[model samples]
Target chain A: NAGVTQTPKFRILKIGQSMTLQCAQDMNHNYMYWYRQDPGMGLKLIYYSVGAGITDKGEVPNGYNVSRSTTEDFPLRLELAAPSQTSVYFCASSLLVLPDSTEQFFGPGTRLTVL
Target chain B: TQLLEQSPQFLSIQEGENLTVYCNSSSVFSSLQWYRQEPGEGPVLLVTVVTGGEVKKLKRLTFQFGDARKDSSLHITAAQPGDTGLYLCAGKDTNAGKSTFGDGTTLTVKP
Candidate 1:
């Protein structure tokens, strides 16, 4: 399986601009998540979906939106980008949340710079 | 909100030496995971400890979860240059369906 894959390895956006970060998983995972990693800040969850048509806000959901229309795809949208949004974004998926099956498969990550 | 704090935010050591890094939190978790990340890449899972006081070892690395389920530690024996990376610990909140990540410990092993 290709596991989880994210598009646009690198991107630069002007202030107030918008873009969609695409993610897909071939594992048919029911849980997909979007996280951003800032220098020395680790990974912060932006949004997540339990399944298609369902999404929830995470710790840092501001300026971001997500849609999980299929089991394989979970895309993150950044509207009116700001310099604060500059960070590396990662997409991950897991088959289940049980103790033994919660291992998350993560994508290579997309580096975003907002000016 | 549950927060995880990692110690020795940055460590530089010579190859063949041993080192340990810690991840502590005040809140309990259902399970905890360890991951290693290289520059420009996402983290890859190293191991997950569910039961408290559980110990799992991978090659030269050993991972242990605290008996109270509030902390964990990673110990590397005879570290190598390949072991240099960002080590992160994440506490899983199954009920919330999310894992809280630690700031991560950056390790640099010199040959």
Candidate 2:
């Protein structure tokens, strides 16, 4: 199984440009999440969906938007790219977030650099 | 906001040595997870401890959750070069229905 997969392993963007980071998971997970990791830091929650059509903002959701149109895909959109958005973005999915299911599987991550 | 703090931000040792990394939070958690991340790849789940004082072992790695459920520890026995990477600890807050992550502990095991 591909588990979780992300497109455009790496990309370079200019200030004010917009783009979307694609994320898909084949594990049939009920919960999907988007996170960003800055250098020398841990992953910060960007947005997440409990199920298709049910999305919510996470710890750091500003300047970013997400849509979960299907159970297997969750895409993050950056309306106006900024230098602060430069980081490695990761997509993860878990069976569920109940007390018994907490382990998350993550994708390789997309590296974005705003110049 | 729930925050996780990891100690010994960096560590370097020769193979066969042992090391321990710590993650602490003032706020209680319903469950906590540990992950290891290699150079250009994503983080992989190592273990998860829920109950207070819970202990789980994976190969040569030992994980422990504090009795208060507000802290955790990861100890590697006879570490190998392959164990070199960033170790992160994340906690789930049932109240918020979300998880928070620590900055991470970077370990380098030399051959």
Candidate 3:
């Protein structure tokens, strides 16, 4: 089964442009997250949703927006992209949390470059 | 700030060598996960340690969680070129439903 999938594998945008990174999961996981990884750096959380219609800010939420309106989709939006926003973006999904929650499953990633 | 910090940002070694990477933090974690990532692909889960002082082995790889629940380590025995990749550690976020990832450790194994 396709666990997690991300769209627009690669994109180039001029400054001030807007775009959305699409993410979908087929596992019906309740938790979804968006993260960005810079070259040689660890993944930084951008935004997350615990379930449908529930979104929250994360460590690095600036210049990004997210919506979780369904159990299978969590999309991140970049409005007015900046050079600093150029990075590889990833989406992840996890099953409902308990003391024994499983590890997150990740998407291949979307590479975005802003000029 | 990242909840976890990984050490030895980069490592290079010859085949058949042994190596260890560390992930440390001041906050207590309910669970810590290790992931290995290749170029152009997402990180894949290697193992997850939940109990303090617990050690888990997967083939030639060994993972241990610190007694205090604030640190963890990944040790590779008889490393091969196939083990070269970016290694990351993520800790479950106690304040939320998500987990925080540490800056990854890049490993290069030469044959």
On DockQ, the candidate that comes out on top is: 3
Cα distance off (Å), candidate 1, residue B89: 0.2
Candidate 3 lDDT over A27-52, as tens digits, reads: 98999999999999999999989899
TM-score of 3: 0.98
Tell me the docking grade of candidate 2: medium
lDDT of 1 by residue, A1-115 (tens): 8889999999999999999999999998999999999986689999999899999998999999998888899999998999999999999998784676788899999999999
For all the models shown, what interface RMSD does each have? 1.0, 1.0, 1.0
**lDDT by candidate, in order shown:** 0.94, 0.94, 0.93
As for DockQ, the candidate ahead, 2 or 3, is 3
Predicted candidate 2 versus true structure: per-residue lDDT over B1-111, tens digit per residue: 899999999999999999999999999999999999998999998998999999999999999999999999999999999999999999998775568999999999999
Native contact fraction per model: 0.76, 0.73, 0.82
| lDDT winner between candidates 1 and 3 | 1
Per-model DockQ against the true two-chain complex: 0.81, 0.79, 0.83
Give the candidates in order of TM-score, highest first. 1, 3, 2
